[model samples]
Target: MNQLLNLRAQVVKTLLSVQQGQSLSTILHQQLDQIAPKDRALFHELVLGTLRQWFSLKALTLPLLSKPLDNPTVESCLYVGLYQILCTRIAPHAAISETVTATKQLGFPALSGVVNAILRRATRETEQFQQTLNQTHGLPSWLYKRLKKDWPEQLESLCQALKQSAAITLRVNQRKIGRDAYLTKLEDTDVQAQACPYADAGVFLKQSVQIPELVGFSQGWFSVQDQHAQLSASLLPNLDGKTVIDACAAPGGKTAHLLEKFKPSLLIALDQDEKRLNRVTENLQRLDLNSDHVQIMAADATTWQATRMVDCIVLDAPCSAIGVLRRHPDIRLLRQASDIAETVALQKQILQNMWQQLKVGGTLLYITCSILKAENEQQMIEFFAEHPEAQEEKIIADWGIPQTHGRQLLPLDQQGDGFYYCRIKKIA
Candidate 1:
C-alpha cells in the first residue's frame, strides 16, 4: 500500500511540476530513474494522459469543488484521480482509493476526504462528467480560438486528434537493411508493424516499445523518426557528393537521415543549445553514422556563418511546436500566444541567415513541427517578398495538404503528427 501511494504521489508531483512551468519531458527524464521499472509505465501513463486531457479534466473536477483549492499540488491530485476514473480501464474504486491515499501521502491528509468525495461524485455522475469532457476540446482558450480561426472546417477533427496519444514511428536504415527485410525481422519477433504508405523507409509500430530493445536497435538497423519527418530527406534534391547543412539540428534525426540517404560530401549539423548537441552526437554514433563527413557543432543558426556556400540546407527551425502536441502534450501548457511572435522573429532571422549561405540554385528545405500560418505559409510569403533571389520549389507530394506556400500534415489519429514543409531554391 505504501509503495502504491509513493508511486501515485510521484505522479502528482510530476504533474504539479508541469503546472509549475517545467516541461513534462524534462521532468520525466530527470525523475524516471528513481521510479521502479515496473511502476514507470503507470507513472508515464498517468502524467501524459492527464496532460493530454488536462483542460477537460479541469472542467470535470472544478464544478465539484465548492471553492478552488488553494494548494496547487492538491489540485493536481484531483486531476490525476479524475483522469484515471474517467479515462482508464482501472476500476473506479481502486482509482479513487489510491488517489485519495496518494493525496494524504503528499502531506494533505486533511484534504484526502475532499479528494475521495470529489472522485466518488465524479464516478456517480459519469454521464454528466463525460458530457463536459466531450464538449471541451482539451486546449487552452487562446489556442482553441487560434486553431478554430485557422482551420474552421477541420477544427473538430484536429482537436480530437490532438487529445489522443501518438504512435511510435521508425525510419529503417536503408544502408544496413532494406525496409522489407526489416519488416520480416519484426514479423519473426512477433512485433506488429506496417510500412508507412508514403515514406519509403517509414514504419509504424502497433505499440510503443523500449527503442533500444527493438530488433535492430543495437545494430543501427533503424532510427525512430516520424513518417512526416522522413519526408524532409526526400523533399530535397539529390545530394550525392554535395555539401549540406542541417541547421538547428540537435537530436539529429533529420541530420542522420540526410546522411543515410544522400551520403553528402559534407554535412554540418548546427544547434545553439550545447547540451542538446550531445544527443545529436550520440544518435549519429549509435547509428554508426558518425564520420569525418559529418560535423556536429554548437552554434547559433541566426548568427553562425558557413565556411562556404552549400548545395542544400535544411532549416528545421524552432517554433511553437503546436503540431506535435500529441507527442508532447505539455506544449499546450508551456506555450503562450506571445511566444509565437518571438518564435517567428527567430525563424525569420535564421531563414535570412541560412539564405546568405546557400549557393545559387541550391535547395533549402524549410521545415517546422508547427501548424500555425504565421510561422508557416505567412512566414514564407514574407520571405518571398524579402528575397527576390529566392524561388519556391513546390513540393509535389501525396501526403499533407498543399498550402499557399508549402504542404501541411495535420495531426490525425493513428497517423503523423502535424508538420509543415516548404522547399525553396536560390534561383539567383
Candidate 2:
C-alpha cells in the first residue's frame, strides 16, 4: 500500500460514512487505530475539513463535473482530494496525484479519470473561481433556513464561524497549579497560551496540542473544556456543605469544576451511559478530586433522584447540540430540522422530571450546548408556565447575550463555545 495514499484512502472511507449519516466523531474514534500515528492528524484534518466545507467544495466542483457521479462513496473520495487542494496547504500537484492514486486503493480504478479531471480543473480555476464566486456557505438549506429564521442578523457570521476550527481551552485545576503558574509553564515549553477573559481558571491555547503531552496532564493540572462551559459550575452559588447533583454529567468537566471549587456536603454526578460515566470517574481521579463525597452514578436523572432534595442541582440538559458546530462539524451533515423538535420534547421532559428534586430554596442551573430558542428560551417559557414555582434567577454575568429567560453564548463569542444557561430558584 502507498502509505501516504493509504492515509487519504482511510479519510475517504470515513467521509463516506459521515455522508451516510454516521457521526464523524464515532467513525474517527473507531478507526484512528488503523491510521499510523504520524498520519492521524492529517487524516483528521482531511476528513473534518471535507465535511465542514462539503458544499463550499460543491460550489467549486459542481460546474467542473462532467456529470453527476453515481456512487456517493466515489464522490466522497473526490471530495477528500478536492478538500486537500482548495482548503489545505498541500501542494496541488501532490494532492491531486496522491488522491487519484487512492481511487484504485479504494477499489474504484475506473473513477480515477473522473476524480483527476475535476481536481485538475479546480486547481487551474479555484484561485480566480473563489473570487466572489463561492456563494454557498456550506450549510444545508434546511439548517440555513432554520438558523436564518432564528437569528436573522447573526446567521451569516455564525455560518462563517462554523467553518473554522475551535480553539482548545483548558480549565486549570487550581489544586495542582494556578492558572497564572500554568501560563508561565506553557511559555517555558513554547506552547502559546493566554488567560481566558471570562473564567478565571481558564487558559486558551493559541495552538492546540495533544492533550496528554501537555505538562502536568498526567498530574491533572487542567481539563480540556470550553471557556463557556467552565462557567457552568461557577454559576452555582454557596455550595459549602450543601448537597448538589450534576444531572446528565459525563466526562464530567463541570462535575470536576464544581467539586474543585466548592466544598459540597454531597456531590452526586449522574449520567445515563455507564461507559461515559467511567470517563467522568477517570477525569475526577486524574484531578485528585474524586472522593466519597463525590459519587459517580450511571442513572438517568429524569428517571432517578435521591431521597433528599439537593441544595444545588445542575441540569446540563441534552438538546440538539447545534451550538457546538465549530467543534463538531459533522452536526451540520447529521442534524435535521426535525431533530430540533424531538430534542425540545425530551429536554422539556427532563426539565419537568428533575424540577421535582430541587428544594424550595435550592438552585437549579439549566444548560445546553444549543442556541436554538426551542431548546433555550422557549423551553424556559414552557417550564415557567407549567411550574408556577420555578422563577428564572438572573445570570449576572459579563458574557453571553441576555435572553428573556436565560443567557446564550453564540459560537462567534471571542473566547467561548456556543452555550445557553438558565438559572432558576424554586420559590413556591
Candidate 3:
C-alpha cells in the first residue's frame, strides 16, 4: 500500500510539474522507472485514467470546492483523490481518508478538509454531478468546438470514444510463429483473443493482461501494437524481396511488421534518437526478426539521405497525436494549436526528401496517428498538388469510415487508430 501511495505521489508530482511547464512523459519517465514494477503499472493506469477524465471530474468537484486549492501540488493531489472516487471502485470512505492522509504527507494537511468535502460530495451525488459534466461534453471549449466543426455528424461518437479506455492489441511476429498457432497457444493459456482484421497477424485481446503473461511473449510471438498502427505495413503492396525504409521507426513497431510480413531484402529503420533505437533493437530481438536483412540507423528522417533508391518507403511522421487522445490524454493537454503547422512542414520536408529515395513506380506510405485535416488530408492535398506525378488513392467512405483526404481511420473502430495514410506512387 505504501508502494502504491509513493507511486501515486510521484505521479501527482509529475502532473504538477507538467502543469508548471515540464514535458509530461519526460518528467514522469525517471520517476516511473524508480517505482516497483507492479506499482509502476498501477501508477500508469491511475495517472492516465485521471488525466483522461479530468475535465469531467473537475466539473463535478469544482462546484463543491469552497475556493480554489491555490497550490498546484495540492490541486493535483485533490484531482488524483477525486479521480479515485469517481472512476475506481475503491470504497468511498477509504478513498477519501487515504487520499486526505496522502495530502498531509505531501505537506498539504490544511487542504484535507477541502479534499474530504469535495470527494464526499462527489461520492454522495455521483450521477447528478456526472450528468452535469456529461452534458457539457467534458472537454476544453477550444477542443470541443474543433471536434464539432471537423466532424459534425460524428463528433459525439468521437468524443465518447476518446473518453473510453483503449483496447489492448498485439502485433504477431510471423517471423517466429504463425498467427493461428499463437492464438491457439494464447487460448490454451486461458487468454481470450481474436484476430484483428487489418494486419495479417494482429490480435485483439478481449481482456487486459500483462504482455509477459502471454504465451510465447518472451519468445516474441507478438508485440503490443494497435491495429491502427499496423495499417502502414498493409498499405505497402509488393514489399516482398525489396528494399524498404521505415523512417522515424524507433521502438520499431512498423519496422518489425514490415520484416515479419515482407521479409524485405533491405529494411533500414531510421530514427533521430539513438537511445530509443535500443527499444527497436529489443523488439526485433524478441521477435527473432532481427537479422542482417534489417539495419537500425540514428538519423533525422528529414535530412537522412539514402545511397540508393529503395523500392518502398514508410514515413510515419510525428504529429499532435490528437486521434489517440483516449490512450494518451496528456497529448491533448501537452499540445498547442500552433504545433500542427511545424509538424506539417517537417512532414513535407521528409516526404520530399525521401520521395527522392523512392524509385519510379515505388510507393511511399505516409502515415500519422493524427486526425487533423491539416496534418493528414491537407498535407496530402498540398503534396499531391505540388507533385503532379503522384496520384491520391482515396480510401472509400462506404467502408463506414469518416472521409479525409487520405485514409482517416477513427480510433473508435475495430481495425483503425485515429490514423491517416496515403499511398503515393511516384510516376516515372
Candidate 4:
C-alpha cells in the first residue's frame, strides 16, 4: 500500500512540475531514474494520459469542487485520479482508494477526505462527467479560437486529430537496407509494420517496441522519423555534389536523410545548442553516414556566416510547435498566444541570415513544425516583400494543402504530425 501511494505521489509531483512550465520530457529524463523500475511505466502512463486530456479532465472535476482548490498539488492529484478512472481500464474503486491514500502521502492528510469525496462523486457521476468531457474540446481557449479562425472548415477534424496519440513511424536508411527487406525482417519476428504511403523509405509500426530491440537498430537499419518529416528531403532539387547547410540541425534526422539521398560536396549540420549537437554526431555515427564531407558545428543560425555561397540551405526554423501537440501534449500547456510573435521574429532573423548564404539561383527550403499562418504562409509573404531577389518555387505535390507560399500538412491520427514546407530560389 505504501509503494502504491508513493508511486501515485510521484505522478502528482511530475504533473505539478509540468503545470509550472517544465517540459514533460525534461522532467521524465531527470526523475525517471528515481522511480522504482516496476512503477515507472504506470508513472509515465498517468502523467502522459492526464496531460493528453488535461483540459477535459479539468472541466469534469471543477464542477465537483465548490470553489477552485488553492493547492495546485491537490488539483494535480485529482486530475491523475480522474484520468485513470475515465481513460484506463483500472477499476474505479482502486483508482479512488490509491488516489485518496496518495493525497495523505503527499503531506495533505487533512485533505484526504476531500480527495476521496471528489473521486467518489466523480465515479458516481461517470456518465455525466463523460458528457461534459465530450462537450469540452480539450484545448485552451486561445488555441481553440486561433485554430478555428485559421481552419474553419476542418476545425472539428483537426481537434480530433490532436486529441489522439501519435503512432510510431520509421524512416529506413536505404544506404544500409531496402525497405522491403527490413519489412520482411520485422515480419519474421512477428512485428507488424507496413510501408508508408507518401515516403518511399517510410514504415509505420503496428505496435510500439523498444527501438534498440528492433531487428536492425544496432546496425542502423532505420531512424524513427514521421512520414511527413521524411517528405522534406525529396522536396529539394537534386544535389549530387553541391554545397548544402542544414540550419538548426541538432538531433539530425533530416541531415542524415540529406546525406543518404544526395552526396553533397559539403553538408554542414549547424545548430546553436552545442550540447544538442552531440545528438547529431551520435546519429551520424550510428548510421555510418559520418564522413569528412559532413561538418557538424555549434553556432547560431542568425549570425553564422558561410565562407562560400552554398547551393542549398534547409532552414528548419523553430516555431510554436502547435502541430505536434498530440505527440507532446505538454505543448498545449507550455505554449501561449503571446509566444507566437516572438517565434515569428526569431524565424525572420534566421531566414534572412540563411538567405544571405545562398548563392544566386540556389534553393532554400524553409520548414516549420507549425500550423499557424503567422509562422508559415504569412511569414513568407512578408519575406518576399523584404527580399525581392527571393523567388517562390512551387512544390507540386499531391499531399498537403497548397498555401499561397507553401504546403500545410495537418496532423492526422495514427499518421504524421502537422508540418509546413516552402521552397525558394535566389535570383540575381
Candidate 5:
C-alpha cells in the first residue's frame, strides 16, 4: 500500500474507537510500527497538527467548496491534503499533488476532481482565504466562548497560549544528585539546561532530550515534570518527617517529588489503576527512593483513608483536562461540554473524602490539570461553604500564569501544561 493510504488507514483505525480519556500519542505509538519511520513521523505530525488547528483548516477549506463534506472518508482525505498545504512546511504543489494521488490510491479516484478543484481554489484565493481561515479556524467557538466568559481580560492570551506546544521540564531527584551537579553533567553532554525559577529542583531544557539517556537518570537524578506540577510538592508547608498522603498519585510524578522534598516519616501513595500505579513504582525504583519510607496502594482516593489523620495531603483531583490541550491534542476532539459536570462531581467527592483524612493544622493542596472554573474556583468555593474550618493558604501568588482564584500555568507559555492549584489548611 502507498504511504498516504497507510497514513489514512492508521488515522481511521485510531479514531474509530477514540473514546474519552485515551492518550493520542500512546494510541499513535501503538500503530507506529506499521509505517516507514519517516512517514510515521510525518503522519503523526499531520494528524496532531490538523486536530490542533482543525477549526482553522475547516474555515479555510469550507468557502472553496459549496458545503461541508459529509462523508468521513472524503472529509478525512480532504483534511489530509488541506492540513499539509496550510499547516506544514511542505511545498503547496507537492502537498496537493501527493494528497490527491493518495485519495485515488485509497479507493476514491472519483473524488480526484473535487480534491483538485478545492486545492487550486485554496492556492488562488490566498489573502481572502487566509483571513477567513484565521477568523474561523484558530479556536473552536464553544471553547472560545467559554474561555471569553471565564477569563474576559485574558481570554485572547489564554487562547494563544493553549494553541502553542508545551515545554519539557524535569524535576531533579535530590536523593541521587543536586540540581547544579545535574546541570553540569548535562552540559558536559552538550544538552542545554536552565533552572526553572519557581522550584529548586526544577530545570528547563533549551532542547528536548530523552530522559533515560541523560546521566544519573537511570540512578534517579531527575524525572520529566512540568514546573507547575513541581510546585505541587512545594505547596505542602512543614513537610519535614511528617506523614504525608499523595492521594490519586499515578505514574508517581508528584509522589516521587514529595518523597524527595519532604523525606517524610511515612509517604502513602494511592492510585486507582494498578497498571498506572506500576508506573509510579518504576519511577520510585529507578530513583532508589521506593523504600519502606513510602507505601504504594492501588486504591481509589474517593473512598480510601488512612487509619489516622495524616500531617499533610496532596489531593490532585481529576477534572476536565482542558489545560493540557497542547500536549494532548486528542482532548480537543474527544471532550464534550457535558464531561465538565461529571468531572466536577468526582472532584468534589474526592476532595471531601481526602479532606477528612487531614489532621488539624494539616494542609490539603487541591490541584487539577484543568482551566475550567467549574472544576477549580467554583469547586473550591463550594468546599469552603461546606467546611468553614478550611481556609485558603494562597501559597505562591506568582508561581504560574495568573488566574482569579489560583495560579494557572498555560500550556502555550512557559511551555508547560495548563494547571490549577489551591491550597487549604485545616484549623478546626
Candidate 6:
C-alpha cells in the first residue's frame, strides 16, 4: 500500500513539475522507461488522464481551496487525486488515503491534513460542486478565446476532439508485403485492425500496441503514422527519379513513406536539431529504407545551401501544434497565444528560404499540424500575396476540408491529427 502511495506521489510530483514549466514528455521519457513494466501503463494513464481532464478538475477544485496552497506541486496533486477518484477505476477510499499519504512524499509532510480535508470534501459534494463549475473549453483562456474567435462555427467540435486520445494508425510498406497479407498476419497474431480509406497504406488498429512489439515493426513491413499524416506522402506528385526533400523531417515518417511509395532519385531529410536528426536516421535504418539513397542533414532548411534546386520539397513547417493537443497534452499547457505569432514568423522564414531550394515549376508541399487560420489558410494567403510566382495547386484528395488555397484536416476521431497542406507550384 505504501509502495503504491510512493509511486502515485512520484507521478504527481513529475506532473506538477511539468505543470510548473517542465516538459511532461521529457520527464516521462526519463522516468517511464525506468518504471516497472507493469506500472508503466497505469503511470501513463494517470498522467495522461489528469492532463486530459485538467480543465474540468480545476473548475471542480477552485471552490474547495479556501486559501492558496503553499506549493504548486501540492495543488497539482489534488488535481490528479480528483481525477483518480472521478475518472479512473481506482477505488475512492484507496485514492483518498494514498493521496493524503503522498503529501509527505512530495516533501510537504505538514500538508497531509490539508490534502485530506480538500479531497474528502470534494468527494462528499462531488456532483453538486461540479455542476457550478465553469469551463475554459479545456484550454487556456487566451487560446480558447483565439480558437473561438477564429472558428466559432467549429470551436465546439474542435475542442471536444482535442480532449480525446488519439488512436494508433499504421502505414504498411507495400514494397515488403501487401495490405491483405499484413492484415492476415495481424489476424494470426490476434490483433484486429481495419484498412483506412483515406490512404492506400494506412491501417487503423482496434487497440493500441507498443511500437517494438508490433508484428512487423522491426521487419520494415510497415511504419507508424497517423492516417491524416499519411496524406502528406500520398498527396505528392510522382517522384519516379526526381529529387525530393523532406524539409523539417525528423523521426523520418514522411521521408520513409515517400521512399516506400515513390522512387525519388535522391531524398534529403533535413532538420535543424542534430539530436532530432539522429532520430530520423535511426528510423530510416529501422525501416530498412536505403540510407545511401537519402542524405540526412542537420542544417536548418531555412538557411541551408543546396547545390541545386530539388524537384519537390515537403515542408512540414513547425507551427503552434494546436491541432495535436490531445496527442501531446503538454502543448496545451506549454504553448501560449504569443507563441503562435512567433511560430508564424518562423514558418514564413522557412517557407521563403526553402522556396528558393525548389526548382522552377516544382511542387512544394506546405504543411502544418495547426488548426488556427493564422497558421494555416491565412498564412498560405499571405504567402501567395508575397510570391506571385508561386501558384497554389489543388490538393486532389477526398479527405480534409478544402480551403481557399489548401486542404485543412481538422482533427476528428478517425480523421487523425489536424493538419494543413497546400501544394504550391513554382511557376516562376
Residue lDDT tens for model 5, 327-380: 776787788887788989999888989888889999888899988778888888
Per-candidate Cα lDDT values, in order, are 0.89, 0.85, 0.78, 0.89, 0.77, 0.83
Measured against the true structure, the TM-scores of the candidates, in listed sequence, are 0.97, 0.96, 0.92, 0.97, 0.91, 0.95
Model 1 residue 381 lDDT score? 94
- Model 3 agreement with the true structure over 99-119: per-residue lDDT tens digits: 787777777887777877777
Ranking by TM-score: 1, 4, 2, 6, 3, 5
**Residue 100 displacement (Å), model 2:** 0.9
Structural RMSD, model 1: 1.6
lDDT by residue (tens digit), candidate 2, 196-285: 999989999998698899999989899999999999877888898999988999979899998789889899988899988988989988
Residues 257-360, model 6: lDDT tens digits: 98888888899889988888888888777778777779998897768878888999999999988888888887777887789889999999999998988899
lDDT of 1 by residue, 142-166 (tens): 9999899889989999888899998
Q: What is the Å distance of residue 148 in model 5 from its true position? A: 0.9
Q: Which candidate would rank higher by TM-score, 2 or 3? A: 2
Model 4 clash pairs are: none
lDDT of 2: 0.85
Q: Kindly provide the TM-score of model 4 when superposed on the true structure, using C-alpha atoms.
A: 0.97
**Which stretches of model 5 miss by more than 4 angstroms?**
1-4, 8-26, 124-131, 401-405
User: Going through the candidates in order, what is the number of backbone clashes in each?
Assistant: 0, 0, 0, 0, 3, 0
Task: List candidate 3 segments past 4 Å from native.
Answer: 1-8, 21-29, 33-41, 394-404, 413-416
TM-score (C-alpha, index-matched) for candidate 5: 0.91
**Could you arrange the candidates by lDDT from highest to lowest?**
4, 1, 2, 6, 3, 5
